[model samples]
Target: MLIIPAENAVNWKRPPWVTLGLIMTCLLVFLFYQGGDSRLLDRAVEQYLDDGLLELEAPVYEDYLSREIRLQGRSDRVYDLQAFQQAREGGEPFWLAVSLLSDPEFYQYMTDNRDLLLAPAQRADWLARRVPIQEELIGRLSAFRFGLVPARLDVYTLVTYQFLHGGWGHIIGNLLFLFLLGYTVEKALGPGRFLLAYLVCGVLSGLVYTGFSLGSQVPLVGASGSISGLMGMYVAIYGLRKIRFFYFIGFYFNYFRAPALALLPVWLGKEIYDYWFAGATGIAYMAHAGGLLAGAGLVWLLGKSWFQVRESFFEPDESALDDRFTTGYAQAMGSLERMEFELARHQFEALRQHYPGRLIVLEHLYQLARLRPDLPRFRELARELMAEAANHHQPERMVAVWQEYLAEGESFTPLEAEDHNRVLFASLRHNDLKAAEKAFERLRQLGNDVLTSEACRLLASEFDKRQMSGRARYYQQLMQA
Candidate 1:
């Protein structure tokens, strides 16, 4: 089964150059440096063979003399010494002969018998060993010498091992996860802390892996352990935010959603299960688990503020409409908060046509109108809100609608009149005199509507009780009108 968290869909900051740089460095090292080493070793072996300085005995001798190792793309195809000798003559390129040196038995025999084969000057070359010629030693040196070895811990291996991957698939898998999790993590922790956290997590994980697998000769390579640390940090940083996850098991495929931290236990549990039962698969599950713990522990130390900064991770949207809506709305709101009035106005206006029905959008437009009261958009937004509120039967919303509309020196429409009466009667029935009074004035604007007579009478009575005869007479005239 494969499961992954839903990637973030919005990026609020710059691209993660550090993560990209690390990936590129790993790619270059694998493709150019490590790959070229094998070819160089082949050349060195061929030169020694052509000069007749190299000799071998039966088994090892005939093996190097006749064995064929053909390079097919990135793979090696081996041919038995007898069959290869019959098929090809001695005139073949020296490098083909050199390829035979890769055989562990042949490489061992040559290393052990270097003294018999080498002249005094050649002895210096053998002793210097600048070029790795021993197949077993080369493999071991590539892994244990540079890669992290639990049995022989070296401080440099902690960081270097993260850059050395066993194969293309290994590096690609590590970088994919590093990109997904690392980008956001870098943003949360900031570039400096992000680097620190990454290395620290990797080192801590390596230490833990070494502690558990003590005395084991296997060398751990790849960024999986460090990326696992990022995963742990991801969980801690996101905390309670609902994160979507994608999963596949055999033919089954689906998605699930849960609070970000909820998956932490699931991930750790899988690693533990694999480490104990699937040891033969050759994965360093111990390192992965350790990295996870180290990452989470580091984030816990950083506290909640770091997590808050992580919300900017972007997961590009598949739907164009959603992208525009979210992007535009966010930009508009963000601009307003920053007091960037011109940009906020532009964003608000752009969204006005597309999101005219959204209450939140309309509310923001109304706010813009209050700030720039003369702007026609405010009145338009207020009108749209009034109609929407009426359709939804939201009396409280009409309060702003009326306020905005009236502040713009506009009279109530017939629908506005009906809504005013709804509020007026509801308020009077609920004994909210303040609200009833506010509604009474708007109700007065709807002359000859269904509730006008009762509203006028109510206003006149209230004025008379307050001993305000002049206002009472005005309402009496409105009643006659």
Candidate 2:
């Protein structure tokens, strides 16, 4: 449902107001879905802290409190307040733990259902538990392992782990990244391929997480792994394509556009820094790395031809039109020589339209028209060419025109043998035996050797076409002489 405006120049035809309104609406919707409610978010934090489910340290409390409201469902503020007070008095953190556990899920659900609710943080807790993975699904997918051992892929853990986020902020951040990257990768690779790549990257990410944090009880969740993969593929395919990003330094925010490929190194550097210096709270850097590699590798292997096909759209060559026209003309001529009359006719028609009013082109068109007797407008075109030839005054060109008319059984003034031979060869590029024979007879009477050899070669080609041994032998004798 997210529609990106076309790049480079804005469409002036669309009112600027309409475009601004749509951008504002989408921004508002995104913010609302990503835990943007102030009241509900405060309540969740206070409830958890009062119930002793979360430590009430200054920075930790601030961290929990700073998360955006992610839902607009019926507020349970009164119940949360009562539970917080009761748990505080009884020295029990049961409600606080529940709040902590449920907050992540609430944020995830809000992100999934952004279009349905406009109010911020209304149904946060309702959406937290609907994870999409299942044991039966993994079991079914396991059957395609070929000769590989049938190790189970923990479908329940896979499904539940995807939902068990570290915090509201974590869930919201991952979801936002997913929304931006997932749609673009899906569009480029198509749904089926994109889906396949997504699942593979996710599974590989999980494996990396398990390898690094073996036997750890901390629940790993969020869509970062898949988002990382999308980032990799995007960078690989769109190398220098610019992406605009918002950056915050202290209290100041700035927007900048950079090539997508540049972001890859920056991202990896941040991940490396975090892994070395930051305390481990079960955020799997290895998983993110693995997902990125998988995504990039898959695109490289499967999308080579796709890149070649789409390269024209990204960068067009000015000479391509002329090259295509020349190629089309050559193919048309080949078809004509092979006697593929229909194909030749179509190609010639395209050539005529492509490059209008060339003399050589007109001659070919007229010849093709004469061959296609059933063509509805063939006679009309022939008459037109004849009229054009009549008005043309150069004797050499006129002789060529008369020779063609004579070949077609039309009346024309007679010319000497040498003139006829010169015109015939000039008019026809691939002269066959019939035309050559007439030319040869005229040349023989005039004692001309210049065209004799060419005529004999044409006669030999005709004999070969008819499979006539006698005519072939006679041509061979003439050639030796």
Candidate 3:
């Protein structure tokens, strides 16, 4: 089963150039470092194979068996090197010997054999023994020097490790996730902060992996940890938003929409569950979890901190425009408070120019029209608002606007029979006698079915409360007829 995000639920103001640049860098590094499919993992696995040499230069299998048998509790069962070597060739002996090696217990062993197992010199020696595959020695030879190995970690490998990939599939999968999640995160944090956070998260992930894989000699390479950080940031920023994800289980596929934060626990839980249950599948789940935590922490700090941030790195900047718009909006509100009708009207007009199709601006203008009672803009704003509400399927909003327009002692706009009857019944419910009576007259003119026996009965009660006994009796007699 796989779940993939299609796009973000919320739209941001800027493009994701920083994310794009990161993807390009990862691709370039992959092509440059392992373009020939250097078979580096193949060579690493080969070193673990038994070569039938008990006493010889670099007896890799025998050295492994002696150390394993001595470290494992089965040391009493093995009497000599030959016996241990023979058992090492069998499946049962191999698993029993390597069990501790896969765990943290093997850390001391790897530390003691650092010169033979973890050093670049040993890797170079191994490569030298093989027939040169390429004339240019530029590829797998660099993984050991740059990749992060918990057993032999150099300070520089923390950042360098993220730029390397074990294979094309590894790099491609990481890049896909990076592009999907990083774009939104970069836009949220802006470019400069995004880059810094990414590198920091990657470093944190490497540290977490080092803590977990203490004795492991295999070099961890890939941008998954950093990309996981982006996923974390994406969740933090859009946590409350209802985002859509495409999910597939075998041949069945469907889409799910849920709060963006909902997936965070699901993802983190999966990683933790896999770490305990799935064993190692060449994946650094601890590193992924660490990066996710680090990214969320950094985002929280950045959002809540008092530090002044630099300008965002996206082009066609809108920050200044947004500030100006906010200031202008405040001024418009202040003008209304001061009863500067013409001034407020002018400000609302200016706002409408910038915020065309914005209902709030139109609403303010509609209020100005009602207060002035002479401006033709009131009718114009009313017509626009009603149409806008109708198009948006906001029937309640439409009723509200119509009622407000009628309260201004304006004629109701020509509406369909259903809408007219709805407004009439709503006005009656609110005890807006004047609006309801006007709506009723309009309904009568349209010859709608609104004047049924039930309607007449309800209107009679409302009329009797208002002391309109003659109108009440008129409706009552009509109901009888």
In candidate 1, what are the lDDT values of residues 246-310, reduced to their tens digit?
88899999988899888889999999998776634658888999999999888887656543344
- Count steric clashes of candidate 1: 7
Local accuracy of candidate 3 as per-residue lDDT tens digits, 1-481: 6776555532445558888888898888888756644445344324333431112222444565576677764352244456544555664434433332222323344435656764575544434432132112312455656889797889999999898887768888888888887876766666787898889889998998899888667678888888888777766665587767878899999998888778878888888888776643668899999888877666667755521133442223357767877888999999989999899989989988876756787878877787754556666777677677766666567678877766673653345455556666766766666666666666666665545555667788989988999989988887787
Instruction: Name the lDDT value of residue 405 in candidate 3.
Output: 67
**Per-prediction TM-score, please?**
0.50, 0.36, 0.50
lDDT of 3 at 175: 89
Lowest lDDT block of 10, candidate 3 = 130-139
lDDT of 2 by residue, 1-481 (tens): 1111111223244323422332343344335532333344444445445543244222232232333222322132334444555665676554554444444333343445545642355333323322221112211221111101113345555433443343457756766666556555655665556656666676666777677655333345556776677777777666687765556677776667777677677766666666655543446777787677767766777677532214322432337866877798899899988989789878888887866644566778777776644554454554455445545633344444445555653323233455556544543344344555665666666666666777677667677777987988788789889
Output the TM-score of candidate 1: 0.50
Instruction: Give the Cα lDDT of each candidate.
Output: 0.70, 0.53, 0.68
Ranking by TM-score: 3, 1, 2
Best by lDDT, which number? 1
Model 3 vs. true fold: TM: 0.50
Candidate 3 off by > 4 Å: 4-14, 36-140, 306-481
